[model samples]
Target chain A: MDTLINIPTMAELSAKGEQPDILFWVGCAGSYDERAQRITRAFAKILKHVGIKFAVLGTEEACTGDPAKRAGNEFLFQMQAMGNIEVLNGYAIKKIVTACPHCFNTIKNEYPVLGGHYEVIHHTQLIADLIAEGKLVAEGGAFKGKKISFHDPCYLGRGNGVYEAPRKALEQLDADLVELKRCKSNGLCCGAGGAQMFKEPEPGKKDVNVERMEDVLEAKADIVAVGCPFCMTMMNDGVKHVEKEQEITVLDIAEITARANGLL
Target chain B: MLAQIVFTLVFIVAVALFTVQVRKIIRNIRLGKNICRNDRKAERWTTMARVAMGQSKMMVRPVAGLMHLFVYLGFVIINLEVLEIVLDGIFGTHRLFAFMGGFYSFLIGSFEILALLVLLGVLVFLARRLVVRLKRFSGVEMKAWPKSDAIYILLIEVLLMTAFLTMNAADYQLQSRLYGHYIQAGAFPVSQFLSPLLPSSTEALVFIERFCWWFHIIGILAFLNYLPISKHFHILLAFPNTWYSNLNPKGHFSNMQSVSNEVKAMLDPSFTPPPADPDAKFGAKDVVDLNWVQLMNAYTCTECGRCTSVCPANITGKLLSPRKIMMDTRDRLEELGKAKDKNGASYHDGKALLDDYISREEIWACTTCNACVEACPVNIDPLSIILDLRRYAVMEESNVPNSLSAMFANVENNAAPWKYAPADRLNWAQGDWSKE
Candidate 1:
C-alpha cells in the first residue's frame, strides 16, 4: 500500500496565478517542522504584500524522494515520488517554491533522472525576485533593527546552488546581516539531513548543531535564520542547549521575512 | 649463486602472473564478464583514469595527497632496484653496465639516496598511521588495526634498508682493502669513508656484497609471492588498470546489455530472463560476485585508504565505508577460497544480501555521490557495484523503500517522476517570471 504526497509542478502551479510566480514544494521537512511552516507563511505574506500571485500546487505536493533515495530506501522514495508524478501529471504545474533545501535540491537535480523535469524554484528565489522586482520593498524597512545572519542549509546552498537567494531576500529587507566565516559551498551540515532528522548523531566529538551554533555566536549575529526546516529545528534546539552563554534566536528565513513585513 | 637462482624464479613467476592476469582481463571483456554497469564502458574508463592515474581524488585532502604522491613515486622508483637485483643474479655482477662505470655509478648512487629518502618517507607514513591516527573504516582507528599488508610492506622496506646499510658497512671495509689496488679513479666519498677501516682483502668485499645481495633479493622474492594477496598488489595491478581504464564522461552510465540479443527462445515469457546471467541460477551478490579483474582489485588495492578517507558517505559516518566495502569483499572472497568447498560464506546469518554484507541504511546513504568512486587510486569502482546491487534490489527483488515505491509507480504509470495532469504536460514552459 502506498500513500502519495503529490505537489504540482512549478509551471502548472505558476499558470494558476499571475506575478510572484512561486513554484512551491511542500517538502517533507516542511510537513514535519513547525519553523518551516512559520517561515513560508511569512514569505507568502511578504510576496502577497509585494503583489505576487503565488500559485499553489494543490494536492500534488509530497516528499521528493531525496531522503528516501539518499537513505537508500528507494522503494519508499519511489512510492512517495510516484504519488507526486501522478499529481503533477494531472495539472500543468509550473514554477516551484519550497522552504526546505532538501526538497529544492531533489526536485531540481534528481527529478529529471526519474523524468520529473521542471524549472524548480525555492521560496528564497521568489523572495529574491519579489525584492528585485521592487514589489516587496523592505529596504530600510521591517527588520532594520535586528542583527541577523543566514545559515546556508546544505540542501539549499551546496545541494542546489541557491547560495545567494536567501541572503538577497534578507538584504531586500535591509536586516542587519552578518556572515559566518564558513559560509556558502563550505557550509557545514546541521548534521540533520537525509532522514537524519529521525536518527541520533554518533557519540563522538561535539554535536554538529552545537558546533554550528558556536560558529554563529562567533559571527556575533543575534539571530540565526535558515531556509531549511531541519536546520531551524536543529539550530533552535541547539540554541536552548547553549543558551547560557549567548542569547541566539534561530528562526526560519520566512519567519525573518515575515517579521520584516510585521506579518507574524 | 643459490640466491641468484631463487631470485630469477620468483621474478619469472611474478611477471608471469601479472601478464596472465592482464591478458585474461581482455579475454574476460571479449566474453563480456564483468560488465557491471549501465554506464558507457568508455565513461567508466575515463573515471578510472581521472581518479587512478590522474590522482584527481587524492587532491581532495592535501596532506593525504602529498603522502600518497611520495609513496607512489617510491614504489615506481624502487622498482628499478628490483630489476637491478634481478640482473645482478643473472649476470654475476650488480651493475648492468660495468665498463661504462661513471654514469652507472651515479645512477645507482642516486637510486640508493632516493631509496633512503623513500625509506624515510615510509617512516613518516608509519608515523602518520600510528601517531596521527587516521580514521579509515567506520571511524575505526587505522593505526591500531592489524593491517597485515601494510605492516608487512613496511617491514620489508625496513629490512631492505637495513640490509643495504649493513652490506654497505661491510662492503666499505672490503673496498678499502682494495683502495690502493684499484686507485685508477678519483676518490669516492662513500669508499673514502671506509678506507681506514677496510681489511686489505678483496675477498671480504665480495663476501659482504654477496650477503647484502642475498637479503635484497630474498626480500623482493617474498614480496612477489604476496603481491596477489597483499595491499601492495596494486603496484602490479595499477599500471594496467590505469592504462585500460573505462575512459568516458563522468555523467554518463554504461548502457545496459540488451538481453534479447543474447538469449534465444525462453522457457517462460514472463520469467523475466533472470537479469543477464549465463548460468541464470547463480547471480553475483558481492565483490566475489564480481569477475576476476574486479576480484583482482582485492590484490590491487593499495589500501591507501584514500577511498574511505574521502568517501562522502563515510565522512558523514554512514555504514557504506567504500574501503570497507572493498576490503570486506576481498576478505570474504579469500574466505570463500579458503572454505572447504569454496562456498562456506554464511550469506544469510551474515545478512549476506542486505543488512550484513552492507547495511541497508549504509547502502541507502549513498547520495549516489561519486566521491568514493572518484577517490580510489587503483581504479576500483565501488559506485558501479553499489548501483548494480541497487538494480538487483530494485528490479528483481522489489525491495526498494517506500519512498521510491511511489516514484517507480509514477515512472511506470505516469511516465514522469512527479505528478502532473496528463493533459497539462507543457506547463513548465508557460510560467511567468517577472511578476515579483
Candidate 2:
C-alpha cells in the first residue's frame, strides 16, 4: 500500500493543540473504493500544494448516510447520520470539504434539518475558490488541447445547482471543455443514483448509464471528467462497455487538476 | 305546465347523480394519509393564480397552450349562461336574461362567438389524437379506455356546442316570425347564419328550439357526472392541486418523522431513544400510506403525457413512465373506492398499488429526477409516489435489487456505501507533498 504523508486527524490536531483551516471529509467511497481513493488523494495533494491547513477525521469518520436515506432505510440512515453528527459536533467542526457528491448533498442539505449545521462545500468549489484567490495556480500540462467532456453528477448539478465550479476548475487545464447534449439542468443520471448503484438495474430496454454514455460519446471527447465518484464508476463502466476504455479515460476534476499542476 | 314539470324532474335527477359521484371521489381521496400543506396561504393563492387561472405553465408549448386556453376559458365562461337557461326552464320563460337589454346582447353575442371557438378547439383536439397521433398520446398506457375516453370527451364537446348553437339559431328564426315568447333582444352573429335555413313555420321553430334546449341541459349534467371517472376530472381538481403544490425547492425530499425522532435520540446527549415500534412502517406500502395531497394529485392528472414525454427515464427506454405511475395510483384508488361502495364499508381487495398496479421495475427505473413534477402543468407529483413505493420495497419488503443490498450492507457496516473501513479513509492523501 502506498503510504499517505503529512495528514492529521481531528484527535491528532487536538492533541497537538492546533486546528486546521478546513476539515476534509474523506467520504466512504473516497476512503475505500480504489478508483475514488485516487480522487481523494488528488484533492488532498492540491490542498497541501496550496499550503492550506487541512485535517481528516480518520477512524472517527462514517458514511454521511446518503445512500441509506435514498435506499429507504430510514432506521439505518438515521443511525448513521446521528453517529457522524456526534463526532463532527465533538470536534467543533465548522467548515467541511468533501470529494463525494453523496456526502456533500447529505451533509449540506440534510444534516441541518437534524440539527447538525455547518458550512459544507464540495472540493470543486474549494479548488475553484483557491484558484480565484491566487492561493493555487493551475496550468494546461498534458491536457492542453485535449477534448474533455464533463459529466454532471445529479447531486452536484441538479440537486445543489453547482454546475460551474467544476467547469471553472477544468478551464484551468486549457482543454477543449465540451458539454454533453443533456448538460446542466437537463443532464441525465448515470444509472447509479437512488441506491441503484448498489444493485442490478430492473430489467429495462437500456441501462441508464449506457444511455448517458451515448451523450459522452456524442461529445466526442478524449476524457470524461466527473465530479462524483459514483458517476466516475458508471462512466468508466460505460466506456469499457463500448470497448473504448483505451481511447476514453474517466478522471475526477480533482485528479485532472492535481496531474496538470504537477502535484501527483 | 307539463314541460316545466318534466324539466324540474330532469334537473333534480341530474344534480343528484352528479352529487353522488363527487362525494365518492372525495371519499376515495380521503383514504390516503394526512399531510398539512395549509401554511403559506399567500404563496398558495399566487400559485393558483399563475398556474390554474393564468395558464402560465401550459404556455411552455404555445400552440397547445393557446388551444387549451380557449377550451378552458370557453368551458368556464360559457357556464354562466347555464344559470340563465336553468331559470328559464324552471319558470317557463324564454331568454330570461333578455330583460337586461344591451348587456344581455353583449353576453349572448360573446357566448355565440365562444361556442364557435370551443367547437373549433375540440375538433382540432380530436384531429390531433386521431390523425396526428402525437407520440405522447400513443404510448402503451393510452391504448384502451384512455384512448377512447379522450375521443369521447371531444365528441361530447362537439355535440354540446352544436346543440347550443342550434338552440340559438331556432330561437332567432322564431323571433323573426314573432313566435310565442321569442323576443328579438340578443344578437347571434354566428348562429344567425343558420337562421335562414330553419323552417319558417312558428311551431316548427319552437319545436326545434325546445328539443335543442332540453338536449343541451341534459348533456351538461351528464358531462359533470362523467368527470369523476374520466381524466377530465382535472377540470374540477386542477385548481386545488395547483394550490396545494409543494413550494419547497424541487430537489428537497420530505424527511420521515419516524427517522427524525430516532436521529434526535441519538444526537441529543441527555435524551434516550424510544424502542423501535414493531409495526411501524418506514415508507409507503399502499395507497393508504401515501399522503392525501398525493392522492389528490392522482385524481387531478389529465393523462396528457407531458410528464412522460420529458422524463429522462422514459425517453431512455426505461420501464418507468411517470404518467403510468400517476395513472396506476388513480386506478388503484378507484378500485378501492368501488369495493368500499359495494361492500358497505368493509372492503378489502387484497391487492395494492405496489407489485399489482405498479411494478418494482417501474419504481426502480426512476432517477427521482423531478422532471415529471416540473413538466406537469397541474403540478401533479409522480416522483413522490415512486419514492414512497421504493421505500416500501427496500424497508418493508426487503426486496431491493442485489446491488442495492450490497451497498446497504456497506453503509450498515462501514458508515458509507463502500466496503472500506474508517481508518484508511485518508490513504489517498499519502504522497510526495513538498516535491511540487
> In terms of lDDT, which candidate is strongest?
2
- The chain A TM-scores for the candidates, taken one by one, are 0.85, 0.97
Best candidate, DockQ-wise?
2
TM-score, per-candidate, Cα-based = 0.66, 0.86
Question: How much does each candidate deviate from the true structure in C-alpha RMSD?
Answer: 8.4, 4.1
- lDDT tens digits, residue span B1-436, model 2: 8889988888899889889988888998998888999999999999999999999989977878988988998999999999998888899988888989999999989999999989888888888898998899977689899999999999999999999999999988888877667878898989999888888877888888989999999899888888988999899899999999988755567778777776676667787766777756767877888999999999999999989987767877777889999999989999998988998766788899998889878887777666688779999999889888878887778998787788888778866676776566666666554443
Number of the predicted model whose TM-score against the real structure is largest: 2
lDDT of candidate 1 over A61-158, digit per residue (tens): 55565654553444445555555766665554556667767766766665555446778777787777766876665554646676788887766664
Q: Candidates' lDDT values, in order? A: 0.58, 0.85
Reference-based TM-score, model 2: 0.86
DockQ of each: 0.07, 0.38
TM-score of chain A of 1: 0.85
Which segments of model 2 are wrong by more than 4 Å? A1-8, A16-22, A41-54, A122-151, A160-185, A216-225, A242-264, B98-117, B169-208, B260-280, B316-318, B433-436
